[model samples]
Target: MSLVRRIMHQGFMPLFWLALLLSAALGLHQLETLFQWIQPDTRAVIYSRDSFLSLLLNHLSIVGIAALVSIVIGVGAAIAVSRPWGRDFLPLVSQVASIGQTFPPVAVLALSVPLFGFGAVPTMFALILYGLLPIVRNTLVGLRGIDSSVLEAARGVGMSSVQVLLQVELPLAMNVILAGIRTSVTINIATAAIGSTIGASTLGDPVISGLVNGNTAYVLQGAILIGLLAVTVDSLFERLQNSFSVMEDRLIK
Candidate 1:
């Protein structure tokens, strides 16, 4: 299992990201010069101390945590609603998730600030709300779209409800669920930079600082890194979904 995981890690996804990584490497080398061009007209200050890797890692941690929260709640709520007893709550769950997202992330951050204080916590709360709708919507769609015959066959084999759900239904629906996650994480990667406004250290820190201080260089730096991070993660998720599809095909054969 460990060997399989290692192979999947090293051989599977990285192959898709080779070009993106190379581009980022090249961009990092010219990051300072790139900043100068962003505002040649203005006396923009470029602080070269913060490396792209450092900023990227900080951004990753913030978005990573919030995405985890989103997946747990979004997927769990969908699963619950798919169950017989919880089926009645499907509309309610869907509506509530819609409402949560309709409330702006900035507004959510403002509300959470009083309770959580100014930090990543409020930012994470806002993003968790932001990421919920797609995941829940997708999971519900995936589970509901499953073929009845397949489910009945599992049940005919004496599979318990739990076994059928865990071993059969979820595995079949895994790619759909993961697609939702892919969307959520990609969106969050760009959105979590807002956390910088409230004191969370992220790639957005430079952007916000630039906006406030009128230094276009900082904004350019943050924007480039955030865009690259989003692309990197989106590629990884795309590769993962492809891998799941291949695995599913193998099982069918």
Candidate 2:
């Protein structure tokens, strides 16, 4: 197939288009409301462009940083615990990640405020914690899911322990690991909205402000934007997972 055709067939295209449509539609709706509010005779309060942009940037930055941290920690921890010596520590790590997921994002933000102090720090911390579980769990599952015979074969072929893991196990387990990272990223995108609650500027700022002032339009705008972002990221991850799966299949064959 031609490159263009292959690109079109990939799942990410449709998702990207869908996200664009949603964003455009939502943005237009928001703009109309904003224009109406700006009229001198209108009773509604106007939302400034600066504030809106700041809120969006804050959210993007927080989610991006959180996902980055989660990837490093989650993947690193996963790799660590997959080894023989680290295997015994897996349950404890799993339990901790589970606790992170169970813990309220807001509560984490609140607790972290004192130590991390406002802005994006507390928000990033909460999101990192919230996003760790899926990646770590998936890493463990992926590494463990590798066929024992395959691992033994690699070792018998004179591959070192590290070589067996890096060259044999990890390649086979890439699909599951990518899937977990995708899940963690998408969840973090949604959860990052809570950052606005504790004085961290994010898409949630509009929603929270709208609630305070009883403005449904603003709330809807923020809600739509946040939802679109999450959908877009999720779709991208799905494509990545499919690609990884295909690679694993080809490797096995």
Candidate 3:
């Protein structure tokens, strides 16, 4: 009963958002009347070049792949630099990550098209580059933010360096790290839409097509789905972060 109640509290918003996202992707054609009202002059209101569900899936795949790579590289770099031997390279790593973010996503895509050609590859590359900064920065902050006294205590209790890092530092820093990931993923979700311009199949296809053809309905559909996806992912991350915080508090008590 307690577990059920807890799941209900934590799962409701994410589930709601997920339901809306899925419905929009799978059942958007049902809203043709609404779209027609929005774009009365246009012959076709709902985007039909490709299915919304397909676009949504492709978008997720791009963002998911980019985010996975970003998390591994970001978290790994942060952990490495936090150690004694690697501390000297921290500034260089941070500067590189920041520079990666400074470049515009569109610019990166344009630059990548020649190298990678027009497809998901360039989009994923752009997303990975653009999404890296937040995760790396947040990871650095999280790992660096751990209390030195607590770390010393861990060592005092005869824990090795690896054990202290694994058992003490990572756990304490997880919430902040998760926040960084949340931000990165949210940013990638929106930016991934731009990839449609470069021939990447994403939810942004409708928006790009709508703009090119002056069809507002298509734009609205794409925007709605993209917005819903971002909200859903952010909410899920919030729940996870909250769970971590609760566990940390109980441990402290």
Best by TM-score: 3
Tens digits of per-residue lDDT, candidate 1, 1-253, equal 8435744675544555655654663465465566567677665456454666676777788888888888898899999998999989999987776676677667766777788898878888778888888899888878987899999999999999999999989888988999989888877776778878887778888788888878877777677667767776786777677778888787668
TM-score of each: 0.83, 0.84, 0.93
Candidate 1, TM-score vs. the true structure? Answer: 0.83
Worst 10 residues of 3 by lDDT: 1-10
Candidates' C-alpha lDDT: 0.77, 0.74, 0.88
Q: Whose TM-score is higher: candidate 1's or candidate 3's?
A: 3
lDDT of 3 by residue, 21-53 (tens): 999899999989988888898789999988989
Q: Candidate 1: which pairs clash? A: none
Report the lDDT of model 3 for residue 159: 100
**Predicted structure with the largest lDDT when compared to the true one:** 3
Q: Distance from true position, residue 224, model 1, in Å?
A: 0.9
Off by over 4 Å in 3: 1-8
lDDT per residue as tens, model 2, 89-174: 88899787777677766677688889888777787887888778888988888888888998888988999998887898878888
Residue-pair clashes per prediction, in order, are: 0, 0, 0
The local distance difference test score of model 3 is 0.88
